[model samples]
Target: MGRIVGIDLGTSTSEIACIVDGTPKLLPNSQGKLVTPSVVHIGEDGGVLVGEAAAEYLFTRPDCTFMEVKRLTGGGEVLKAHGKEYRPEEIQALLLGYLVRCAEESLKEKIERAVITVPAYFTDLQRRATAKAGELAGLAVERILNEPTAAALDYGLANLKECKNVLVYDLGGGTLDVTVLELFEGVIDVKASCGNNHLGGKDFDEIIMGRLAEPSDSADPSADERALMRLKKAAEDCKIALSTREEYQVSLPFLLTGAEGKPLSVEKTVRREDFEDWVAEKVNSTREPMMSALADAALTPGDLQVVLLVGGSTRIPCVKKLVEETLGTVPRSLVDPDLTVARGAAIQAGLIEGSINNEDLVLTDVCPYTLGTAPLQHGIFGRRVFFDPIIPRNTTIPAEKSKIYHPAVDYQTEVTIDVYQGESSDPANNERLGELNLSGIPPAKVGKESVEVSFSYDMNGILQVKASVLSTGRQVSAEISTTGIKAKAPLDLSRWEEAEGARKFRPLIRKAEKLMAAGGDPGGDVELLVRRVKEALLLKNTKEAGDLRDQLLGMLEALEQLLQLQDDRTLGIDRP
Candidate 1:
């Protein structure tokens, strides 16, 4: 058996880490960098390119290349670029496949049994899509942890060893997640959570791109489009550069293209202050949400002992300054802010594999929002439809919750069901997660009929829904449809049996074999990690060293079978 690897499948950058002995450690890429850009390029023939190579092609191959993919996680239209359309899930799997391969190569072992992280605000469809991406990549995704919760775990294991209340402020590349965690004895309890799925670093990039766009002129639309893209890329570079230096220079060498399709190169130097000012609006949006999450958790800024920041966007001086100004205390820099979530996820994997003693650690998470369904309640204007919440916000996961509904009219023989996911009372305002219809009931006075609606959400955030007529055992069913993260719309199995996309993604069967050959596939940077794990365990602290030894052996063995085929159906692994 081998160790279980933890992955932060982030929107902008992805990272993997593992626990050695009793401590968490980051697994670096071949470049010796902890974070790998979650970007990928699909060649004309479908051979995939990932990481730095893929990032390099972003500007050069704008058409065929896909980035900022986490934007389209659920069922939505595929994005078009470089004259090609891409389903978000497909592109995501490609990225996951690359990371899985990198993990195997780095560790020189068979890698299996991974704990992957997702945004707290991801809808059911979105979560399912993420899971499918892991399946396609060939890793047995043991659990899908929330990103903010993972950050809290990192804080719990490393800094907040003593019982204390903490808040995790995670503003990443594509979403914002705020979680309140309390450390009691050894448990890391997430009291409350909230976030904006459409906000974060990519929004900052778009803001700069908007500001850099050349003023529109009716006569030359093509010129403006070319100039804008060139300037936008240049502005983004300057933004990233300024974070590390007092000031940075930007060169938009091809601000505008000539009649022969040649580009005009322009240059500019940007100061940190100026760039921050340009992005102030994007940065300010975090304030309201931070305050809202505080209100929801019934805490004020003064109540927090430690405010942990997680994500690459937090590296910006302005972003850090704003948080400090609001909380009146600088956040602790104990964890490599960028790798904290991945480290936390790996720590969780260790616990799940029974390698680490969880007697001291319990992670209690909340449902970020409400789950409901749309049904006609009245016939004011020919059957008025509205949302009825089943499970309210902030409920714990791996939880079973149910709500009962009764007939609205006399002699009703049929009932319409429209399942929804969101906090709004209006069905239109919330996303239609799924729906079904129930029939074949004894025609009785509508007020005499009854139905039981139940929903069970597993720890991984996958959902199971059930609706049964009490009088008649009559029911219908539907599961959150997930063909891949790249699916633009749910492919109806009956109508779309061909499944061109489904057959295209190769099952990770063979890759699992190579992964198993490696003793412990710890993901990328495994070679250095093996050395680090050994050094950490040899520490003079007897108790800590013993804990690490047990954890390491457990992870090593589990990692071995994670690549092998398991016969258990309930665990959700596929047969060879």
Candidate 2:
């Protein structure tokens, strides 16, 4: 039995840790750095490179180097490198293998098992993909621990005797997760978790990129992969620098060639205030999830004893301010945000392998999403399919719940149990996990034949559904298989045509679009505001859309004035 380790496989970076003398300690990578860039590069010589070494290739060999593959986990999208196609998990496996080898070298012993952490809101397919990546890295995965839960475990281990409600706000490079849990007498019971998988620090970097590239309209810099990579790196640097300083000078010389075949550059001074303004909406977006988590936990902000901050994104001043304002308490970063999740993972590994006593620390988690079957229901519109939740979101894990449903039509001999995962009332609006056909339901009146569906979600977040025909005593079961599943498409908003208030936004939306097309707005502010307005409309959030509409009108006026001023200056006409 080799040693078990803990790993945080993150979007921007990854880390490995282990328990030593009952304390979780991070292990430095091959380069002796505590955190490794989650970047992979395939060399022309057929060798694979990861971490900081591979990060350099991202600039020179952008085609062969891949970063941020974590965002694509569990999707069927294929990544091409060195004339070969690789799945997202395979790319992650390379990073994992590199980390494990480095750890083995440092410890002078083999590590055979690991407890890896993912966002609390990761889906069943994503979890399975992460587990597969671990297996490919040649380790037996002990558990797929939620990142926030792991952070809570790390904190709870050190405060075993305390009884208090805690909240973990984790905003990393590519995701945001808000979790509420209770800690009492060595027990860590999670209440709820909520998050947006598509939001985080990377988004902030993009804001900076847009700001930096605003001055250059002669060419599309994004068309050049190498140029885009350089700009991305510079944007990230600017973001990090502005964290401490009020302003940072972004100087990217010869970034790309202009339409006229001349080298173009990007030189600008980015103020922290401006950056915050640009990202305010995104930062504030975390509020809803935070409030939702607290509500699900049945705890108010005043009830929280401590708020823990995890992930690098929390280092942002605006992000911190938002958390403080929303939670009414300053978040504590006692453990390094960049390192906490991995440390917690290490603690979990310790508990599993007996490095730490199970009696001294116990942890329990919850399902982050709702799981249910779609059954026919009699509604005002006659018979329609509605989602019937078997296990609602935030319910304690390793939980099982069953529901009884009858056949929809008389003499129906079979019933197909369509399982879904989401909160939408319509099954079509949610993700369809899989379906089980329970045949042999002896033909009888619709009300006479009944089928009972059982959903069992485990500690790992995997779902197993079983359907039984009561009278026939026949059964069918299936573990939802998401292997090679295609990535989900963006929410369909085509039905917005018939939405009640959607008509009112068309003229405003059209005006914003025209202003954006006029292309005088430099900071990309006009574009950002317009996109947000459209998003609000898509969500049928009339209130938010209305508010954004007013903002967009004001922004358009300001942009027009700025553009007019620029034209006047270009024409050598000065106005008092």
Candidate 3:
């Protein structure tokens, strides 16, 4: 039997790890890097290249090279390369196969079994697609772990004696997940999880890309794949650079040819303040999920003992500040934010392989979405289809819940159980997993025919539904399969609103914006302060915003004094 390894198959990068000497350690790739770029390129000779080797071709061979395919998993989209069609999972499989080969080489042993991690908000179809990718890579998947839960495992193993309410804020390359868990005596119990799968660092990069192409004289820089790829690469670099430095110079020479046949370039100095402003709305979008997760866990900001930052995006200064202000606590990155999830998955692999004692560590996770069946009901207007939930969202896994329902029509003999997953009251707004048709019900009045429906959700997040006809004892069950189902659009968060107090800062915001536009401060301090105040307002951090408002007012007064002093000196009124 080969060893079991843990893999974090991410949108921007992928990593492989395993347990060594009772400790989880990350395995390096062929390039001697801990993380592998989630990129693949197919050569004209039908050869496949992955990781760093494939990344080099992203600009030159844009048609055959694929990146960020993790975002397309479980969707009904097909990618084309050199006249060959490839599914998202197939591309992911190529990356997975490369990771496994790297692991085998690093460990000097075969690896045939594995544990994989996915975002907590990933739908059933996405999870199934992830597992399918693992299978396609020729490994027996031991478990499909949630990214936040896996991060908690890594934290818990090191501090087995400490008991604390921990929140894991995971903002990766392509997804955001907020999970609240309790750590007690080596047991990690996840209370609730919420997130936006479409929001992440990639979105921030796109914001930068727009800014980079703003000065181009070309009609459309995006019309050329090579030029677009160049812009994307540069945008990503600029985003990473501004994380540490206050400003970064983005200079891409000859990005594209203009309509006049002259080459146009992108020359811009991106300030961190401007970058934060550009991404403020998207970054602020994470606040709702954090509050939702904390509320679902029945926890207050004061109750949380620790906030663990996970994923690469958490490194952003604005993101870190958001976590601190929203949770009323300083966030901690005990482990490398980029590598913690993989380490946790490695620990889980250790547990499943009998290397780490099961009694020493135990993990329990929750279903991130609600599971239910659509049933007919009488409404004010007429008969309507309503979502009747059996297992609510955030319910601990390996759970079973049953609800008894009656047929809607008189003398009904059959019923179709349409299962859906979401928080909406209407089934049409939710995702349809699978359905079961239960017939052979004895003839009876609508209210008398009772059909018992039960839902079973396992630790792996797979759902199984069973429906039984009470009178005839006829039953039908199925393990919900998401195969052939198109993934629904991203969740709608347009209705989210900031706290009521955010309104009170409008005057201050307007004043700050005016001052920023005047631009007399040489250090750009006024601009930075203005951006922070706006972010605080967007995040609904009244206290932080108020403090920043005071600071801005003071700065404005000082600037006014300096300007008056300069005028007096120029007019010879204060000549000494």
Candidate 4:
């Protein structure tokens, strides 16, 4: 059997890594590219292509291609692209299939199990959706590891320390996760975690691009779209450039159409100083939140042994500086900022498969948000709690916690229990998950009766909610149903199956001969790129994976289209 893989299924790009022999090794795709684009193409022939090939051909063949499908996750709404609406699961599946195939090729065998990682703050449904994606991709998911927890494992292995308090600041492509972990005697204990699903490195890139790109007030819509796309692309290029260079320039082009509908062009330039000055405020905004987390844990920055950084965004010089300035110390850089979680996850997968023993290693994870229910008096007074959390944020998971409540009125036969998952006291300010109806309650005087409400978040990040009427001893327990978010409109996948049926699997092989023939190694960051592709491939819910695959592909296709013209060009350019 092929070895189980560890995946960092990122928002912008995904990665994969696995334990081979006694050391962890990264895997590359057929293109020999380290990180495969988390993209999927719906070909004109009704076939599907995932990874670099799909991404490369997206802009060159936009009519049938779909990309950036991950945005549709938890959307509960169908997305329209290439004249068809796709469900999230289907999109994710395609990406997973591509990854599994890549792994099979590498090991020259079948792989059936894996340890997949998710954002620390992903909701119950999102977690389920992720696991379902894995199932669709044809692997038995051994476990779902939190991204920060995985990073901690990596840290633990490298340090081999006796005990210490380490904070993991995981800033990924689409989300920001801050976790406080206590590492001691082979056990990794999670104290707390906080995150925002809407925030991450992508937001940073967009903010930089949005500020630098010039607006076009042209009458042609298509021209406007193409121009704006270039502007954003230019913004992204500048952001990447600034990461490595002291300064970078973005040229804003003005396309002027002649009388015969031909075009003329003009250019303007933007420097790194102007770019930094514009984004400084955005960069500083994260400080207060980081401080708040420390405050909650009752620990000053000086209390930490290390402020370990994870995620590709940490590559930004400004980010690193800001974090150091905030903490008053230089943070540790033991793992590659982008590949930390992927490697940690791979290490854990190895232990689970007995390739690496758990005799001296243990890991713990925490909840990222608060979980609770509506106040007893508020509902009686016509007050509604939206996302009142029963479980407070950062509580350790796979551990049980509970709170008690009393009856609000006399002679009440049925009680309404509105459950929520967030930190705000006001329900309207939080996310209203669902409510429970506790029936058959014995009629009682006001404040004469009570119920014990319990919440349990498991290692997989799934929540189990329960309520027991103390007086009657009646109880109910359930894994909270996350049907609150509507499912996406289902797309017919028959065409995809038919296409696969007709095609023979063309495997990617890189023997010594092939590598030597390639003239040299694949290039810089080849290992990092390979790891990203493997991580993305291990994500398997067919529908969601398929959708994410489509979205990522679409994004890459858009970029490829902009990058296709072979000319003297810098990475960052403002097109519009």
Q: Please give the lDDT score for candidate 1.
A: 0.71
Error of 2 at 445 (Å): 1.7
lDDT string, candidate 4, 1-576, tens digits: 557898777676666778888556667777765576777778655688888777666545554444555555555866445677767756776777777777678878787887888888777677777777788888788888889888888888777665887888877777777777788977888887767676776676677655654344433423554454555456677788878886776775554453467564434355666656776886677676677677767778888888789887777788878888988884585787777787888888988887877877877677777877877446566844344456677776776888787766665645666667767777766665666666545455666667788878887877777777675455656666646422222222223323322122112212222332543232212222222222223322234334434444454444345444222256454454
Across 1-576, the per-residue lDDT of candidate 2 in tens digits comes to 878999999999999999999999999999999999999999888799999999988989999999999999887799997789999999999999999999999999998799999999988888888999999999899999999999999999889899989999999999999999999998999999999989989999998888789645788877899989999999999899988899999899999888768989888998999999999999999999999999999999999988999999998988999999998964464868999899999999999899999999998899998999899998788998899999999999999999999999876866778889998998999988877877655556668767889999998888888887675345677778765323223333345446567788777667766766777654455655655555556667778778877887887788778888889999999998
Q: Report how far residue 319 has shifted in candidate 4, in Å.
A: 0.9
In the range 355-422, model 1's lDDT, one tens digit per residue, is 66787677888888788878676656777878888877777887778777776676565566677888
Q: Model 1: which ten-residue window has the lowest total lDDT?
A: 484-493
Error of 2 at 9 (Å): 0.5
Sort all candidates by lDDT, best to worst. Answer: 2, 3, 1, 4
The whole-model C-alpha lDDT of candidate 2 against the native structure comes to 0.87
Candidate 3, residue 317: how far the Cα is off, in Å: 0.6
In Å, residue 449's CA in model 4 sits off its true spot by: 4.4
Q: How does each model score on TM-score?
A: 0.78, 0.83, 0.82, 0.76
Candidate 3 per-residue C-alpha lDDT over 1-576 given as tens digits, one digit per residue, 9 for 90 to 100: 768999999999999999999989999999899999999999999899999999999999999999999999988899999899999999999999999999889889888999999999998878888999999999899999999998999999998998899999999999999999999999999999999989998899899998888644445887889998999999999999988999999999998888888888889999999999999999999999999999999998889998899989888999999889898965475877989899999999999998898898998899999999999999899999999999999999989999999988876766888999999999999999878777655455568678999999887788888888664344677777756322222212222135456566667656665755666565556655665565455555677778887988898888877767778989989755
lDDT of 2 at 169: 96
RMSD of 2: 24.3
What is the lDDT of every predicted structure here? 0.71, 0.87, 0.87, 0.67
Show where candidate 3 strays beyond 4 Å: 215-218, 484-576
